[model samples]
Target: MWQKLYEELQDQNFMIIAVAMDSRGIEAVRGPITKAKTTYTSLIDCDHVVSDLYNMVNVPQAVWINEEGRIVRPTEVSGAALSLNLKKMRKTREIYCNAIRDWVTNGEDSPHVYSDSEARAHLPSYTPDIALAHANFHLGQYLWNAGNRTEGESFMRKATDLNPNSWNFFRQMKNLGNRLGSGGPEYMARVRKRSKLGNEYYPLPDMAGMENLKK
Candidate 1:
């Protein structure tokens, strides 16, 4: 899916820097990337430096950077849906992909392109709790990488507790090992908890034609 998008837009100065934010490293993402045969600057972001810089909390969120190194679009749930199985998801991605094409072809003139003020308005706020969550996450990541698995995982849990809205923090910890049960009873429990807390595990993007999606 992403490969096709890259191929279509590559000639028009459009580059897709697809990043995999997996703490378990390249092995966690190698199969998918290999299967897709992606050629457009794919990378493994173990520490999630890109997410840290962009204030992303979920998978598939993306930012649009122009030739001048200016962000024309703030980070939002990207059109690169992992599964286009549902009709609604397909439509969302369709709208998103067309918007990208329109923006790339028309540049500044595209209606899909946001103005500086609009982009700024869409930027995510960095609250103190969120800041602390990131600190705990990185410290956990450092310790986990340095072979202190037990203590590292504790801090990672602290990160998630601090910012439960950040699926990145929770999901990475879940992916660290099979014992945590990334897709088991505990995972489902947390998913339900997210809903009760008014934060869907996978929230729909705030796009046109998706008004039915709960806020």
Candidate 2:
């Protein structure tokens, strides 16, 4: 989806820059990138700096920046262009794609484009605990990179404890083989629990009143 979008809009003065928030480094994303045949600029964030900067709590989020170096949209779950594997989210994908097209053509005039205050309002508020969680997560990444897996897992576990709602931190830790203990819940289990409760992994964007907007 990104490839198609980039191809369509590259000549239109629009670009998509993807940042991978993987603690395992570039090797973890090399195979997927190669398989996808992507040509757009992609960067690896081994320390999740991009995630921290954007307050991203999960994977597959997006932020829209206009030509003047201003944010028109804050980071939000952008499963539409990225969740092709999930057949159930086809409608969402369509909505997201249409919005992108509208924005590309209309620029700031697009209804989806929010003002600075609106964009800031859409962002998740950062609490002191969340800040500490991010710090622990970064330290955990540093320790893991230094070949100290045990200590790394300890810091990561503390991070999860600090910010239980941050799926990004939890998922990254689990992917790095950091199980809390014998009785600790696994990633799949937590995901399933959320699913059963109708908690959307990617919350649907509120497209209310957007139907009348030009597309």
Best candidate (score: lDDT): 1
Give each model's whole-structure lDDT.
Answer: 0.82, 0.79
TM-score against truth, every candidate: 0.90, 0.86
Clashes of each: 0, 0
Model 1 residue 72 CA deviation in Å: 1.3
Give me the displacement of residue 49 in model 2, in angstroms.
0.5
Task: State in Å the error of residue 119, model 2.
Answer: 1.3
**Candidate 1 Cα errors over 4 Å, as ranges:** 80-85, 212-215
Instruction: Work out how many backbone clashes candidate 1 has.
Output: 0
Tens digits of per-residue lDDT, candidate 2, 4-114, equal 888887888888898888888899899888888988988889998888888888878898899998888888877452343565466666678789888999998998999
Task: Identify the runs in model 2 with alpha carbons over 4 angstroms from their true place.
Answer: 81-87, 178-185, 192-199, 208-215
Q: List the residue pairs that clash in candidate 2.
A: none
User: Which pairs of residues collide in candidate 1?
Assistant: none
**Candidate 1: C-alpha RMSD after superposition:** 2.3
